[model samples]
Target: MERDIIEELGSLALATRLKNLSERLAKDVSQIYKESELDFEPRWFTLVYALKEGEELAVTELSSMLKQTHPAINQVANVLVANKLVNERKDEADQRKRLLRLSTKGEKLVSHMSDLWGQIKKANDELLDESGGILLESLDKVEEALDNKSMYERIRSFQA
Candidate 1:
């Protein structure tokens, strides 16, 4: 079956390209993270980005939004609070519930980081264009497939 054989080869080629692209993306992210002055892990940037949309969020809400375990999110939130990047306050309606909000300093830092990221993205787009449309098209397909799958399902498929 020549058609079946061709499809198998195509799948293998796609898989190899995906792996290479993932490696490059990881390196790029590491480089970007190194540019930040904060002594925090790269994941902290996700939290910062999440808070960029609004001021206050309950700890549980943030945990859900970030798709992180409650304890893990709590630990990150605590570190942010200690660094004065985020403030914790008791909810007015329910004093027992704690709300987390970005501090003014945090907002400024996020804004600056956003600008830097935008520049990096523009540079990356230029480079991708120079490399031809193959990589960009492949990444777009991967993103669409990911959007159609659950996060865990996508991760499991990658692991396999």
Candidate 2:
């Protein structure tokens, strides 16, 4: 077997490695959705989940709750609206603010997809268990560490 350079690079290639893994996982999930005849993207899960819980929420609120950027939230929201799975409107009291909620179609799809989501969860748990079971915890620690001090900051400090 050929030695994988990315794996060998370890933390030096953390971003690449993680991205590769993420893309692979996304492809698999997309395949699952395709097989099930669902018109959904793996990226849409977070926004959908947030809207599901919050019912009707402002774009800023969804951004904060999802820990994603306003632009990111807006991009997904637009896609959802275009797909007819979500409804978008201006806040009546604040015309400048955009509001979002699942369309009836979205609600129906959610109910239909609940079981498939459970299966995906179970599969992910098993995969995590197989991979030493601490990846998520380690990722959380890494995220918090980066939040306290970004990679750019840490890198620049080396020259001091």
Question: Each candidate's TM vs. the true structure?
Answer: 0.56, 0.92
What candidate 2 gets wrong by more than 4 Å, as runs, is: 1-3
lDDT of 2 by residue, 1-160 (tens): 9999987888999899889999999999999999999989999998998877538999999898988999999999999999998999999899989999999999888888899999999999999999999999998999899989999999999988
How badly does each model clash, as a count of residue pairs?
Answer: 0, 0
Q: Which RMSD values do the candidates have, in order?
A: 7.3, 1.5
Model 2 TM-score, 2 decimals: 0.92
Question: How big is the positional error of residue 18 in model 1, measured in Å on the Cα after superposition?
Answer: 11
lDDT of each: 0.76, 0.93
- Candidate that scores best on TM-score: 2
Give, for candidate 1, the lowest lDDT window spanning 10 residues: 34-43
